[model samples]
Target: MNVNRRLNVSEVGDVTVVRFVDRRILDEANIQEMGQELFQLVEEQGKKQILLNFAGVEFLSSAALGKLITLDKRVKSHSGKLILSNIRPEIYEVFKITRLNTTLDIKDDEADALAAFAALQAT
Candidate 1:
């Protein structure tokens, strides 16, 4: 992984946590590429649920949002889910306005997000 890249990825149990540590998603030109990277990483690792932590992200473009939608679909196709965690109030409102929050599992915190995934996996 590129050191300067905004995303820091790791696995926690059956879930893969992709934390955005930077304020931005970095290169707009590589949004799709980055999205594919994330998808492939989870798929290759056989991770069912994913926690996309956006706590450090201050802004995200529509392109990034589109990529997230793509990722959500990919995860669901495998009978899994993508959960958005630690979304700031402002960014949460953006997702709300766009109605992505309704489609994606949007959690207020990491603990709740992980618990939700674990509970789902238990079923």
Candidate 2:
């Protein structure tokens, strides 16, 4: 697709690795733009294994979380998988408080997340 404005997209093996361009994902307008880009990866690009690396992301709004929830559903509908990695403790606490930690597959780091994806492929 066209150059992603809010994310950097790449592929690692069979997984699509995505990194945020914005560290603070709090702007309402940007969140919507980000959501569309994320959905395009699954809907048009037909990506199944998606991993979001949040190493640079320090803030995530609830609206952003809603987009992730929707993205997770879209991935599942397509028989795909989505994993989140390298979330900072502060941002992670938000996920924990929202109970997203239980719903989303999160890993301590990118390596761990990739391994988890491989494990899923093995089984």
Candidate 3:
């Protein structure tokens, strides 16, 4: 496993599980670093399945959201899948308000996200 400053990365089967290092994802520099790291997972590291567990995050800035959008696109462009799980209600509200809920695959928990991944493979 490689070192990550903004994310805690692990693997469950073929799925790459990524947890945020910060509770609030608002800092510009950290967000930038985080974005690069995320992009590298698909662009450079060849990760095909990514699960972003937002269990520790309480807030995220628009810039952070932008990075997520970009990450999702990059992952898809690689024929990979991205799933978000364990989002707090407030943060989920933000996604809903932004209509990102429709654009991204989200689940109530890591288990559900993993199940979704398994379902995809089964198909």
Candidate 4:
């Protein structure tokens, strides 16, 4: 559950893109810590957009999903946007089954996600 083992992040324009490179996003207490770090980054940066690239993530837990919910709201409160990108099929299925696909913005790639965020900000 080492938070250090999971998340990786970088900036894309005004977007803070966090890539969860690990296979497991939950099943440990560190997920919460990772969530906290992401929360703080959004707050501190005044970031208007985010792209969560799940390309490397193979599995997700309810805890990780909860973190996503937290992040979604954090971005929303700032009038910012959060876009989930590169979701694998298995993980995407989980999101679909949980109906979270309705609550969050899912995209096929980084460019599409960033474009959607830009459009949201433009409005």
- Positional deviation of residue 35's Cα in model 4 after best superposition, in angstroms: 0.6
3 or 4, greater by TM-score: 3
User: Model 4 over residues 39-104: C-alpha lDDT tens digits?
Assistant: 876787576677889887878899889999999998899887788999999999999999999999
lDDT by residue for model 3 over 31-103, one digit each (tens)?
9999999998998899999999999899999999999999999999999999999999999999999999999
lDDT of each: 0.80, 0.96, 0.96, 0.82
Model 1 misplaced stretches (Cα beyond 4 Å): 1-6
Local lDDT at 89 for model 3: 96
Score residue 101 of candidate 1 by CA lDDT: 82
Candidate 2 Cα deviation (angstroms), residue 39: 0.3
Winner on TM-score (2 vs 4): 2
Residue 32 error, candidate 4, Å: 1.0
Residue pairs that clash (backbone atoms under 3 angstroms), model 1: none
Q: What does candidate 1 score in Cα RMSD to the true structure?
A: 2.3
Q: Give me the runs in candidate 3 sitting further than 4 Å from their true place.
A: none
TM-score of model 3 relative to the true fold? Answer: 0.98
Stretches of candidate 4 off by over 4 Å are: 1-5
Model 4 scores a TM of 0.87
Q: Model 1 lDDT vs. the true structure? A: 0.80
